[model samples]
Target: MDTTYTGDVTPGGAPDVRELPHLRITKLAVDPQMSNNCYLLTCRSTGESVLVDAADDAAALLRLCDAALEGVVTTHQHWDHHRGLAEVVAATGATTYAGAPDADAISEQTGIAVDVRLQHGDRIVVGDQSLEVLAIAGHTPGSVALLYADPDGHAHLFTGDSLFPGGVGNTFGDEQAFATLVHEVETKVFDRLPDDTWFYPGHGNDGRLGDERPHLAEWRERGW
Candidate 1:
């Protein structure tokens, strides 16, 4: 299991978790080049951490999180973002959490303990950090969006595939869900969360919620 990330993201040609995020993010460009984003929210003050969106080669991400990793948070149950969950839990021995309805979907994809099932209004307490679970199910029947905020008001969101920069999630479920996604992003995410919150999506690139807020609203108006 040479699960280390030895690709182009290395330093001196070596995998560099140091560069990943001395604080809370480790994006990996996986095989087939889907370039998904995973996260490790660490509170140096409390010495505890939580991982979100387990990518392929879990050991590598675990190595980046160190031993203080206490939990796993899947923004949603999508293949590219959660395929290595079993390896992550095995490496870190942390409890895994996801949307309540998507629990089985996540379990089937990642053979790890589903310690907690979250809902739209659910709050995840990890050390000193608190994350709110948003049910933005449009890309899939049970898609979820995870949002974290600090006491200082700094925020981070894992928008699975439900919301992206300049675009929303791709529809692959009941046709009505696409409409739901449209409304959800506007009323739930765009109107609810502040524009400055960092949004780490499941694919392509990462950005701020504010950066795409207008587009999200416009998309909804267009009936997309």
Candidate 2:
């Protein structure tokens, strides 16, 4: 295809469009402050795309997306994650999608109501691609993860803040929240997804499920 961009997006400025030849995914990040990751997955055949987590720097996000943008998906309602939500949506008029409970919460901050209220098992359409919604609540009341399966049987998970490389995300010292997050990661993620499943977290670098699979018990026992 003679694509111009390659490799993973960086966490400094507006990333030069990253094209994943393996899965035909186009992603970019804008880390002006919080280093929140914003991704754009485009259907190579259709030119349509979906933006995930419009965190910070709306202008950079818009530049990466522009007319190809189809919709914006919110993984949770955390303030840092949706800092640029209002500006991005207002500028693009892209439909907003979020978990039912979190949809309203995000709307409160962005002031732009969610257009689609997602639930577990729901399918989010992006051109010819479909991303399955996994409701992994715990990091927040309605935090969810998105799973995209490639043609070759591998999978990519967009785990907002639920599942990270070393742990299951911060519970803010709440034991119950910690337990819930742990339980969901075990059942909904580690148990179901394959070892090769690559996950893109909210804040840092990408991680493979296999690299993190062995630490399930440790994470549970530590309870952080």
Candidate 3:
């Protein structure tokens, strides 16, 4: 298993792949304007794959899937996060999944209904592997992070726009929203996961939980 991947990607460029014992994680940057990140998780044993956040560039996303795509999990209802959702689902016939609170909005925005309304603690199967859904509501009512716990290694978290290297996602000055997001992230992520857990964000480079753990108090104090 290779752990050298940095999860750095550029729009219209090739994806950076990380191969694990039972799964392969491919991160790609799409949508030139938003620079959104898209992750594809392929189960090594079964060859089935699931995509997290079909951000944009349908053709590129399709090419990456290469006929092995099984489902698409939208992290939130944000326009940038699902710009290519409709096209990709149409082309691949992949099942759609999203947080229950954002399902209607996502469907309304993309014209594709969500096949599964995921809630906190919901489990999504990708071949022989599975991902746990963690609802971290703040940036959006249904923003969620996917947790992949590897038996042979540390955990992996895919935090859409909720948690990043420096702080949590933007809340548009809504103090309540920021507080809720911080609380959810603190309890569900920082508190539950180990320090070595690697997290892939929606936009930029990835980070480990241990690297970000010390700043929890600072993040809360600044309230971003």
Instruction: Using TM-score, give the best candidate's number.
Output: 3
Off by over 4 Å in 2: 1-10, 14-23
What is the Cα-based lDDT of residue 31 in candidate 3?
A: 72
Model 2's lDDT to the true fold?
0.83
Error of model 2, residue 15, in angstroms? 2.1
User: In candidate 2, residue 49 scores what lDDT?
Assistant: 81
Question: Model 3, residue 23: displacement in angstroms?
Answer: 0.4
CA lDDT scores, all candidates in order: 0.69, 0.83, 0.94
The residue ranges of model 1 lying beyond 4 angstroms of the native Cα positions read 1-23, 221-224
lDDT string for model 3 (1-224, tens) is 69589888899888999999999999999977889999999999998999999988988888889677999999999999998999999998999999999999999999999999999999999999999999999999999899999999999999999999999999999999999999999999999999999999999899999999999999999989
- Residue-level lDDT of model 2, residues 1-224, one tens digit each, is 32565435666554645445433555556664666778888877777888889988888788778686889999999998888888988888888899997888899887889999999999888888889999998999889899998775578899999987798889999999999999999999999989999888887777999999988999989997
Alpha-carbon shift of residue 163 in model 1 (angstroms): 0.9
**Structure candidate 2, residue pairs in collision:** none
RMSD of 1: 5.5
Residue 76 miss distance in model 1 (angstroms): 1.6
